[model samples]
Target: MRHRAGIVTDEMLTIPKWRFAVIGMLEALGVVTGMYSAAMLPGPAIPILNQTFLLWQLGFSALLLGRRYSWNKIAGCLFVAAGVVTAIASGSESGQMLSGVGLLWPIMMVVSSAFQAGATIIKESVFIDAVAHLKGKLLDIFVVNSFGSAFQAFFVLLFLPVLSNLKGIPFHELPSYIKSGAGCFFNVGASSGCDGSPLLPLLYIVNNIAFNISILNLVKISSAVVSSLAVVLSVPTTIYILSLPLPFLPEGVTLSSYFLFGSVILVLGLILYNVPQHNNIKHNSDSDFM
Candidate 1:
């Protein structure tokens, strides 16, 4: 559509400033906090965080978009949540209790999830409004993402003081932190002798960028709740992948039989959640033909 409309210019690549100021800032905070929390926390806590994200997305979608959920959808979400909890609980490293400082990280993750949900719903709402005004112009996902990511980077810098404090870095040492980060990025200085393959961080950056793009596209096509659900559905796949014996791992991790059972339940729940929407689409198609 953009090509046909000849709207592929630099101006077309920009999201509205107001929307970026609001939604983009929230998304940046969410992305930064979510990544920071995960790095500081343990693997077991991630499932709980994912559940928190799902619930928050549902709530945000409902409030922001006036979206209604059917009994099946609710049940499906609950089942997926339960399945993830069960799988993670069974597979998490033994004896690492979530107490004291551990508990704080999960709470932070939940807060991050809430910010993400809010950003997603707001972006979706903006897309909807833009589509309504489409006279011959295209609604470009890249445009929204470009502006949103720019604002996100700005907010990340703005919150550096708080993040630095959380990391126990003195405010005066902020320059040193940046220099150290740059050194690590280029495999130079003190971080040059790190044992891990340099490809790991490169892969992570690629994955994170792709993930943001996917989330934005998902929000554009559907509601934030559905995007969250799509992520919820990936839990099992992630668990299974982790179970593999990769070179980075000291040993092959074994998953409990319960993980398989939970995986099945998660798939079933996702199918249930989509049943109503699928039927509605099919019904509308039949009516069109009739």
Candidate 2:
């Protein structure tokens, strides 16, 4: 059926050579997100860190991208900030400040958001050039995501070995570098079910696919700042859901009805703002911002 539909098939299909540059770095991000979600994790701080990231993107867009700020954009940012504040205020697990390993979660979110913003800029700057020289979007996805996968894989590999070795190695038995490295690596690497589990690689692949695709389309349809805003709008939904108190709720986190409702309203507002309009600011600019 696939062949009849003009679809090609190959069991030995492989990602192109150039498609790996970004993967390793992104993998490291997944690792960080995982670590912060662990038991007794400081959950409120994640939203705060995300808020900081948006502010950074806004500043960079103003300085480097020369993004002309408008009243609507300003309002949008404010709304997002408000939402973050709300989430953070209500995201408390024990109604106390984030502490211990949980204290680092928000910081990780800042780093993650920074990398995401940078990825957006790089992807945009190179996308058109690649299209004119190489293949279009299809090849673009292949090359770009392959490189991303590779980058993420590199970090995963480097840390995975040491982490895997940590099983029998007593904490006092390890050197300072190994101990510190493991702590930091786990901060990002400790995802849903990581451990020495065989499914860790597969989980990372799934996470990358979900994250990268959401971001790739976002950049294609909007500016980095706008894409960052969209992320702000979208991510809370997923996180909130995962944090919910549904049947069989996980040990680490759970969401309330309030968060879920807030996410819905937030997404609706973003869609209204993002929908293509006749008077789009990008149209007024260099037409490239569109």
Candidate 1: residue 244 Cα off by (Å): 1.2
Instruction: Candidate 2: list runs displaced more than 4 Å.
Output: 1-41, 62-66, 91-95, 99-109, 131-139, 156-211, 239-247, 250-290
Task: Tell me the tens digit of each residue's lDDT in model 2 across 1-290.
Answer: 44344332231124333323553555475465545443334556555655666766666666655566665555666667666555545645534566555445456566676765555565554454444444443233444555566677777666654554644565455575565555444554434543434454556678978887767766655566666776777667666666656644545475666566556556555554444445657632323232
C-alpha lDDT of candidate 2 relative to the true structure: 0.55
Runs in model 1 deviating more than 4 A are: 1-15, 31-41, 91-96, 101-104, 136-138, 277-290
Worst 10 residues of 2 by lDDT: 6-15
Instruction: State the lDDT at 199 in candidate 2.
Output: 50
Clashes of each: 0, 23
Cα lDDT for residue 126, candidate 2? 47
- Of candidate 1, the 10-residue stretch with the lowest lDDT total is 281-290
RMSD of each: 4.5, 7.9
Estimate the TM-score of every prediction. Answer: 0.83, 0.58
lDDT of 1 by residue, 97-135 (tens): 465446667777888888877887788777777765564
